[model samples]
Target chain A: MPSSSSVPFDYSADGFAVRDDVTSIHRVSWEKIARAGSHWTGPQRVEIARQARAARAARNDPPWSRDALPGAEGRLPETAVEAARTIGADAHRIDRAWAESMIEALGDAAYVELGSIVVTVSALDAFGEALGRGHEPLPDAIEDGTPDGARLDAATDIGAYIPMADPFPGPNVGRALSLVPEANTLFFSNVMAMYGGPSGSFFDLKWDGPLSRPQAELLAARVSALNECFY
Target chain B: MPAGEQIVGFGEAVVRGSEDLPAAREALRQALGEAGFLEACGIAGIFNGLVRNADFSGIPLDDAALHSSEDFRDKLGLNDFSGAKNSDLSRADASQAGEGLFPHKGQ
Candidate 1:
């Protein structure tokens, strides 16, 4: 039950910490999610991320399909590949039924792990593309041991596919990633750095940055609208 | 807010996986310089993931956020969004939008 304020800007748990020099918060977050998960190995997680990137790239291509790219033949589980692609390319379509089946097939932890990986990679790649820089190279996989398999709190139905832990009085985005603490922390650290540095200056509409706070909020709101995200 | 409007178009292009994203990027760069354009994209990219995570988790809006954002959300018709409805947590039919992934019973 660590309060949101207690999670340091450079927080790392269970042998997972991003390098401080990685000033690019997205890259830092990318490194964290690319690491091994509770069920998937680092390589497996990386592969899933790769597939998610490919899925996002292929989104504008004709004949929409959620298929993994050709090179990923048998490199990861089919369900895992599908989950990554779906979460990356069309996450708004993920209803409870889709999630329940994914959990039933992949186990709750793995499913959560896969969704986290997909969204992280998708976000990074999207940033790269928007910046007119190609996707960042996947960091070398760190061979961490098996996932610690720690479910810190009993999940209750939160109208999502899987039950969620108790709500913290923070942004729903943070709560969204709480089921897996590593993912939650990794994602938020990157967000905090990218948006406001250590000060969490997200709501300061006139703050200094390459883009003004209003400009940043504009981009954020538009993306959220496009994704149909309510929180 | 013309710049913001252009950014909305650029952000939508990036989020929707549009082929015109390069053009959109160029437009934003022209208006906001290279650094500003890059920052705009970076913010949009971060939200792409954040929004998805929130939608998937179905976490409700914080009471403060909901209260403060009521006017804006209403004006934007954000409440009409499927994800917004799902976040209510009290709606019995919230989870019934689509069929559950499991087809067979008790496999």
Candidate 2:
């Protein structure tokens, strides 16, 4: 396998013109996952990603029957392990009580960071899957460091399980990761690259892409439903 | 909704990892050339994360979206989804509907 630094979101071999920003954002996400974050160590983050992948692979199976990952026994706390698995395969069913319990054990910031890692890796892998590329190998080496415990102090509870940055001038989804600003940047940067384009056309009724706005929305809505997402 | 059928089929097949994905991908590529096919793939991939972000964070639906979607939310059974509980639909009013997607923007 190519070294993580050499690995990128390259589609040239596949004969597609993926935007430059999209490729860059995806590569950055991979690099970030291999390093220590606000609440989790590098290895912990990577392990969380692995558990998420494992859970998603068993998505067809009932959660009760899904095999336990090595996370709890080795690096991650049991609460974090459960958070990764549930977020990866069954986020649609995640409720406030369950989330609060996990947060109580892992701390709200840690839980949010873990969720971000799971979703980041899942999104990257899903793109590959959509194009028949299968999964990218996880980073072979993790950066060595202790977590900084940096968290958004001003974050306030907005009826969500955890505190979030004060109401922002955007969709609630855009503010979803605000408690961890880096997490918000990590995920939504990819979102903007992949969908919104340079002018932030997500709100625009007309689009100039090869796919029309409706065609794009059709794909987006269908995928959201297939995942059983309510939002 | 011209190419909606093909787009939806491709999305369902890909997300499910179904055996039909190969066939669905080919159909979508034919309908929307190579560029559109790729963009579609990216959209499918990102929404996987988008949904998780929203659900995991427990963000309620924007009021405008809630009010605008009210008519079909129940009929389409969207109100039954777990995340629907985040938003109180009883507060969805016509005044809310007038605001565009980013009601909080510039305020």
Candidate 3:
């Protein structure tokens, strides 16, 4: 992990332009969150306002301890919310323990734990197919199946899982486990390749990383660049 | 790093879907750029895919013994709107009016 003293992150001139755009988007989102004032206290929203910049300063892969704060008697993971930033952290990471704690924090707040099925079977071949190479850590065994499609949010054109439906556990995890929820967990297990784990070690300081308002902005920009997301 | 370890909670939320869809989507656009927007949708679409499987497998709604949140479940639209209700469907109107046709998708 880079020491807290590392004052600069070498984003070249081009990187600056990209960073600026990401920042502007976050600003807009935070502003919106503040105005909304739902599911969070005004002070809570202020903390979320800091997530984008803090996550960025940590290079988008911040550690857990520095990233989360206690809420409602439990340490809620970064809300990482957008839409004007007063409610939750727009961009942040949540560990498994943290994931559990987040769900735990909900405390009868209308949340569901989607269960995840862990196929202890060898995933080396699967990883090879995904990356065309044999890697030590492999992706989980999850795929888009027929039955899974039936559950799409059909009633609404939005066709997305509603946030109100959130804090949902991994289908394969605990009570949330169903065959398809299991597959969903496997999918979550697989996409880590794109998010930068080992490659992002410099920032995954766990609890030792930066978690302040400015760091959130920096994290948001780095991810926006990597994902090429410009909303 | 474990695959689960990489995405973090929101990372999975990226695929599993976010606490707030449009806002999260918009936020991705801010952080990730246009592709990020698409990625959020793609990630979320996968979760939508699960709804059928979950309902089919006779998957029971999570028992309180597990994860519990009254506000989380029933209030699906609240979190995304920052607690505002999504009773209005302007996007649907535009689509029905054949307006812009999935502004997120490429022309």
Candidate 4:
């Protein structure tokens, strides 16, 4: 058996240093998204992250049969709250019409940011849930920082709902999260570390790991199916 | 195809959280042992987030990806998914609609 010290995990790519306080991969990744992103304020980001968790918790509750549910008060914007609930409970329902409506209400940038928060929180929470550890608390929001608004990549319209930044030989997940670079960085960094490194070696038919690539792919495919995700 | 039954059952249990989870987990444990079984759960948890990211964003497969995965997607009936069917909206439309909503001040 390998000791804890022998395990390889790095977060330098996302500007995080190894720390004794940051024990789990999920906790550190949660800290990354708690910061202000390209569109939302830090407080707003944190609030949305909270709502994402709340939505996940409420997922198994009886469906709000009526069009309006009482006591839906939240710190995040109404549209953002709805987006979080939809994403957490059932992302498959996020069709073009719903996305368009959200963009109209929340603006393209904010909508993108909300989507980023939902995915980030869901990933972390799901990991914790699978391990029976539950969710880690949200870190303090980094206030007084403005969005960098960096659009360095010349994205191409590749039949997606949004333009995709060039990923070259990389998977569609990179391009999918490219609209918000900070989100992309946080998500991919965690994914790369947990699954395998960025070399894409883990995605092949045969690979060196405790789990074969086919077995890994099968788990991925099954989860995607359960989520009703076609990508 | 060697361990298809156990693998598929394990995957389903991981996603569904069904009552069969313990049995499925044990089957996978018997096949891949502890580390591999745990890794499978981790991968499943990862996709639980990843699939949402793609679906919520309405991201479509690039041309090459679309072409290559056609057979696999069809065989798996993935094309019938709601996200795939609803992903026809153009990015140009979204961008044009959001014009002036967020000033690209930093650009």
Candidate 5:
């Protein structure tokens, strides 16, 4: 991983007016991913990110026709690789039974963390691709540490795939990764930086960025439709 | 709403990563200017992850959102999505309208 001191991202050369706040948050996210998380180690988290990218690369292929991911190169197990692949490539098809099976094998917290990594990388990759910049490179070195195995005590089964922080005043989508606070934090950082209004508030219904709220929502709705996401 | 059509076209092209993205990107840039085009790209990118997070987590639509959206969910063909199974749409209160999306904000 780039040392904590190294700048992880610099969009200045991209020539487009990338927001400073957006750049800073992405750097922070990369820093966090390079370090150990609540469940997975730095190397394992990076590996999950790589696998997610690989899955996305093969998104057009049927799962059976895609080349198999290598076996257990990093600390991650084969099941972890599959979890990343499914969540990364075919999340629309993910159902309660498949999620339960993954959770049963990987444990709920680990599964949530893995899913968070997959989705976060997906967002980052998509951002670059949209900007015609392709993907930002994965971290060069993995920080050294073990999984903390920590989880929030307040989380409960909310009738979703796994437990989430309950009584959350925000939308269910906002609390989706609450089972693992780090994962939730990691992903939402990108959400806020990328989509939040000038004050970095997602609830700013009247948000008028360079793109008007309607324009932004139009794009968002179209993207969601393309992804086949109901929520 | 100015460039609404181009924004939708650009978003679709980006998300689908289609062969025509270059053409779509140029058209959106011409319609919305550089700042708007870049912002649109950013929004498109993030929603890709946001949608996955919701689907993989199996979280349902919040009650108010589920209800508020009743008028157009079917019209939009959203009900046909696989993730629609996660929410019990039958439980929505159709009588309730204009319930702001975050009905429980701060409380």
Candidate 6:
């Protein structure tokens, strides 16, 4: 079998009408996430993430979407969950074993690590955008070295792939993704990155062994598929 | 995942399960696509972790109420924290206090 990249050859340009189906899925996922729990911030925020993950396990679908979720109505969506049904979420990506392994590797402590990753990635994104527009990075969105702490390093080594929008473009920060049509012609590029990205990890994977390029992509694909992320 | 168990349950229902499991599940598939359910579940998980970790240690309600919530105190420029007092052991049991964290002290 080809790497994880070898598989998941669906959602092509002509088929989907856009290149970045993956990115679009990610964008929609975030939007739904933001809207799903607008009031939450801080520690409770972490719990919300956990619930989603557990739910994903319970709702196991064939081709995991990672972004998809069953709406208040129940079934998965025929199209994109965000545009039509606000609460609609899809299926999960990996087998129960993978989920269990992930949980085992990173527990609540992973949440803390994820919190930093989310903020760091977002901050880095803002900083990257600002720099892209040619300006000094703002205080509101700096990596603060905190982003590059031990937790992040450990995460990066594992191959979870959790990149953030850094303040200033650097060796670590590459071209960040955005679903805004004006910017990325590829709608689901983010999903693509998340699903089967070749670049180094955005977040670190706790488990480590010998993983081929396809394996990495497949893992990400498993997650995206599980999320039910349709752009 | 919202702090209160009620809200958390509500969220769990919507994201994880659904009000009507069969119909809701189907609709979720059609609307969000295959990843819709999975994504929602993952989102829920992501949010659960994001919120839990951020507030797990619990910021002082007073400080939390304020607009600013610096990771660390003004005095200490570190994100790490140290609790001042121990939780009163007289609190309710796990079943009684409800599995959730208390209003203050010892989450």
Scoring only the A-chain of each prediction against the true A-chain gives TM-scores of 0.78, 0.90, 0.26, 0.77, 0.92, 0.22
Cα lDDT, model 1, residue A183: 65
Model 1: per-residue Cα lDDT over A51-150, one tens digit each: 8777767765542553446556776888887788777766766676777787888877677777778777777677656665556667667776676676
lDDT, candidate 6, A43-162, per-residue tens: 222333333333324333443454444442322122212211111112112222332343354342332333332322222222122112111111121111222112222222111222
Which candidate number would show the highest lDDT if scored against the true structure? 5
Better of 2 and 6 by DockQ: 2
Model 5 agreement with the true structure over A60-106: per-residue lDDT tens digits: 78999886654557568888988999988899999999999999899
Candidate with top DockQ is: 5
Cα error of candidate 6 at position A196, Å:
24
Cα lDDT of model 2 by residue, A17-120, tens digit: 77777777887887888888888889888899999988887777898887554445678887788899999999999999999899889988898899898888
Ranked by TM-score from best down, the candidates are 5, 2, 1, 4, 3, 6
Candidate 3 regions with alpha-carbon error over 4 angstroms = A1-28, A60-96, A106-231, B1-107
Candidate 6 stretches with Cα past 4 Å from truth are: A1-231, B1-11, B14-22, B25-46, B55-107
When 3 and 5 are scored with TM-score, the better candidate is: 5
The CAPRI category of model 6 is incorrect
Candidate 2, residues B18-78: lDDT per residue as tens digits?
A: 8999899999889988888888888888888899998898988887888888777888778
Model 4 interface CAPRI class:
acceptable
**lDDT tens string, model 3, B1-107?**
22122223333334222344335434445554544333332223222223222221222322331123333433433223211121222222212333221222232
- Chain B TM per candidate, please? 0.70, 0.92, 0.32, 0.70, 0.92, 0.34
Compare the candidates by TM-score and give the number of the best one.
5
- DockQ of candidate 6 is 0.02
Q: If the candidates were sorted by their lDDT against the true structure, best first, what order would they fall in?
A: 5, 2, 1, 4, 6, 3
Which is superior by lDDT, 2 or 6?
Answer: 2
Model 3 lDDT tens row, A1-231? 212222221112212221332223223322332331223333333333343323322333334444442232221243322211211122112222333344455321111221111111111111111111221221121222222121213222121122222333232122222213323333233222212221222113222111222332333333332332211
In candidate 4, residue A169 scores what lDDT? Answer: 50
